[model samples]
Target: MKRKLIAMLMAGVTAVTLTACGGSGETSTEGSAANAEGDKNYKIAVLMSHQTNAFTTAVSSGAKDKGTELGVTVDILDGKQDPNTQASQIETCIAQGYDAVLVEPISADAIVPAVKAANEAEMPVMTIVQQMKNQEDMAVSYCGGDESKAGKMQMEKAMEAIGGKGNIVVLYGPMGSDAQLSRKAGYDEVLKNYPDVKIAFEDTANWTTEEALSKMETWIQTGTQIDAVVAQNDSMALGALKACEDAGKDIPCFGLDAVDDALAAIKAGRLAGTVSQDAYGQGAIGVENMVKYLNGEEIEPFNYTECIWIDQSNVDEYIDK
Candidate 1:
């Protein structure tokens, strides 16, 4: 009987050992699944001011395509040209625990705090197109066309087209944007080289066709003989064209941002020329940089792409039919 009891006890011990081993195997499988989920999934957020324009749209498209290539899921949020909305979007990104954020701030100053918060969260933030005011303190990198250079180049081309002497009108964009400031600086620098070219009047168009048209109409009412109009962007250029037509003025107009409409205007001989920043290139590069950062690689603080001059001479190659 004792021998029988000893055998039963041995069997019980064997059963307990088998149970423990099975439990350990199940735990290992669960742990592996959790790890796999973490590796396969990553989230990135892109905050844009407005997608209505070609420039910002190109930026968004580039980010989307690049994010996909790197196996990251991207979320694009539009601020609708509202600074408050943009700030809220950044906060939302942080609350949702996004792995990284890419922002194109609408207002340079308003977005500073939100960007700081993102930085505080240890989230890598990238700015494109428009930069924040305190950029050095907040963003990891900036990727976009050099706006000041764009402005300077546009002015130089305008002066060249007009034989280096003209009474020019300046149509500026949003009042407090870094792009506008840089572009204006460029304009000022280029104008220094051509003393004969005088700025007759400067007006703010706010980067809209209607606003520019209204502003130009007011200038026309003053009876200023505008030899050429320099708009900060293509939309404003189109507006200037309308105003010129309304006032019966046949003057050469220049614009930056080679949008489809701008290219069309150039073909129609309504606009003298424009500078193309290759928004697609900006988007592609921003994405490339973001991916590198994600993979623990160092990135440049500023990446400036080359700009192209688009005029009737070479508009066919750039403009879409």
Candidate 2:
């Protein structure tokens, strides 16, 4: 009887051991399959500053199109020009386990910590338009139009229209933005070549048409002889046009970003020209580069798209009427 009881105990132990081992093996196999499924599904997140602007809208559209083409599940988050919000969105993307992050930073410095966090989490971060101060280490790729070159080209067209000498009013955008700073640097460089061209009044319009209109109106009230207006963007240029019309001043105007309104203004001869920086291309390239990096391909640190000066002489050809 004692031997039979011992035999029964041994059998029970063997059955339990076998059951546990089989269950463990099944779990391990399922886990491997789950990991494989996760690998096959790519997730990408794109964070942009604002969508109200035409340029940003085009960029968003381009990113969506490219992401769809590449079979990526893209999550687009709009910061609405709020830097802190943008940073938070990046962190959320990281927490959500995105494969890659493509950002058009509202401010370079504000987004660094979030980008760093993503990097630490092993997520590839790509910057568009604006670059971080320590860009070499922070971003996998920096892709966009060269703001400085665009600004310089626009200024050159303005100078050409004004015979290289005039009293110029500069309508700038937000103070610390990379685009604004680079564009200003280019404007300054071009202005240096024309000593006779005096800056009548230079002020920030905050990249808004309303603000630009108010600022230009104030400048006009001050009795400044503004022969030409160099608006950092077409929206502000349109605002300046309103002010100029109100004041009965027919001074030539120049703007960046060949927006539809700007193109129309150019055709109407109200504005001289603008530099066409393809925002759509910027967005498309950002996603494309992220995809390439994921596929173990190297990407350029700096991807600069060319700019074209759009003026009355050639506006019709480029404008989609």
Which candidate has the top score in TM-score? 2
lDDT of 2 by residue, 1-321 (tens): 001122321222111111111012210001111111235436677787776677777676666655555555556677778888788877777776778888887886787888889989999998887677678898998898898998888888788878888788998877777888889989988999999999989888877889989988999899877778999998898899899999998878888888788888888888878888777777767877887788887889999977888887888876774
lDDT of each: 0.76, 0.75
lDDT of 1 by residue, 1-321 (tens): 011122321222111011111012210001111111246445667777777677777666666555544455566677777889889878877887877788888889999998889889998899888788878778989998899899999998889877888799999888777788889999999999898888999978888889999988998899877889999998899899899998888878898988888888888888889998877667657766876777777899998877888898999888754
RMSD of each: 17.4, 17.3
Could you tell me every candidate's TM-score relative to the true structure? 0.84, 0.85
CA lDDT for candidate 2: 0.75
Q: Which ten residues in a row have the lowest lDDT in candidate 2?
A: 26-35
Query: What is the Å distance of residue 206 in model 2 from its true position?
Result: 1.8
